[model samples]
Target: MILYIAKRLSAGIVLAVLVTFLTFLLLSTSFQDVVRTILGPSATPETVRGMMAAKGWDRPVVVQYLDWLSHAVRGDFGVSVYTSLPVGPSVLQHLAVTLSIIIPALVLTGIIATLLGVWAASRGGAADRFAQGISLVGYLVPGLLLAIGLVVIFAVQLKWLPATGFTPLTEDPSAWLRSITIPVIVLMIGGIANMAAQVRGRMIDELRQDYVRTLRTRGISTRAIVFKHALRNAGSPALTVFSLEFIQMFGAALIIENVFALPGYGSYAFNASLQGDIPVILGITAFGVLLVVVVNLLTDLVNGWLNPKARVR
Candidate 1:
């Protein structure tokens, strides 16, 4: 297990490096000028050129990429063009906000979906059909639309929570929790539905296996067989779906963040792209790539541990 984990981690590091390099190359080659965007229309050409030179944009693309990479290795992510604050600190603050919502949402979604899936699989009638329908709605609905509908129902009309904006936990923990409730629910809706569907499918397949039938024939209680034997085997595929969903939640929460006006890395990335803030955009992209790689590696390790054949290989 340790060896498998180490191998997966090594592969993830390599993939992250490659992703960062490609993202840098693409952003650097784009026609947009970070300096011009930062300086705005009133700035003279000399000013813009000076700003470019100061940012070392005048250097070759490879040189700039190397410099940025080196700085990243040393924990320096440069300054944000919009705020002139060190990009590392800025992004970290936003990342924390994102995680505050994402982590809880992931946990809640996983637990709720797993239970729903298992229960539906065990029943196999109208309840199962209803669960399937719920999953379909979750999978088909656009995240932005869901977020808007949630806000309208819970925040605007019902006045149960804040419509948007994030409050720091340090400032007021209660208010912070209150503020994030809707966003977390909005974010988890699709994830829970998708996870439940995957779990239900896997559970059904596991129940059909010969081993399950053998257990049943041996006079084992249905609950015991399903919970102990069936669930353990069914978990492997569910873990795979969970890992993919986690990565998607991390990177694709941009639309939800926008809808909730939450200050997160997703919103920063979106704004950076619009402003053509090359450094900030590249920094966020690098972090996102690293996150994805790490999640994939973790998933691989978990899957390997759950399946002996994977560990043996």
Candidate 2:
């Protein structure tokens, strides 16, 4: 297991570097001038040129990338071109807010999906059909549209919750929860459906395996046979889906955050993109690369643990 984890960690580092380099390359190649964008249309050309020179943007692309990489390695994600604040601190602050919304949604989605999937898979009639229908509806709905509908019904029509803005959890826990509830639910809807489908499929497949049949023939209780044997065996594929879904949730949260006006990394990234704040953009891109690398490493570890074969040479 140690060797497996070490190898995965090493691979994750390499992949992260590649992702960062590619993101930098693409952004640098774009036609827009980063300095001009940050300065806005009203700024004189001389001011833009001076700002670019001050930020070392006048240097060769390779030199600029190397400087950025060096700072990134030391956890200095760079200063935001627009805010003139360190990108790392800004990103970290918003990331905490985003996670506050994402973590609960992830937990709820996983639990609900797993239970619904297992229940639907275990039963073989109308209940199963109903679960399938629910999953279909969830899959069909766009996340932004779902978020809009939720805001309209729960915030506007019902007036049960605040439509937008985040309160510090420490300041007022209830307000924080109320503000984030709709976004969390919107985020989880599609995730639950997708995970439920994956879990149900994996469960059905696992049940058909010879080992599952052997366990059943040995007079094991139905509950133990399904939960202990079947579910454990199905976990390998489910973990794969879970990891992918979790990573996808961050990307999806961008649009959802925009729709709900939540101040998260996604909203910051969106604004940075619109403003062409290269430093902020690069910081966000690097953060995303790091996140993907970490998630992939975690998934590999979980996969190896669940399937001993994965840990073998």
TM-score of 2: 0.93
Tell me which residue pairs clash in candidate 1. none
lDDT of 1 by residue, 1-313 (tens): 7888788778887887788888888887653366666667788988977876877777887888888889998889898777788888888888888989888899999998998999989999998998998888888998878778888988899998899999999999999998889888877889989899999999999999999999988999999998898998888889888888888788767877888888998998898888877778878877787777777877777778678787665
Q: What lDDT score is found at residue 35 in candidate 2?
A: 61
Which ten contiguous residues of candidate 2 have the minimum total lDDT?
29-38
Cα lDDT of model 2 by residue, 1-313, tens digit: 8899888888888887787787778877652477666667898978977876787777887788888899899999888766789999898888888889888998898899998899888885887898899899998998888888888999999999989889979999999999899989988989899899988988888778898789888988878988988887788888888888888888877887787788898998889889777778888888877887888888788888778897774
- Model 1 stretches astray by more than 4 angstroms: 30-32, 39-50
Q: RMSD in angstroms, candidate 2?
A: 2.1
Which 10 successive residues of model 1 have the least lDDT summed?
29-38
Q: lDDT value for candidate 1?
A: 0.84
Q: Pick by TM-score: which candidate is best?
A: 2
lDDT of each: 0.84, 0.84
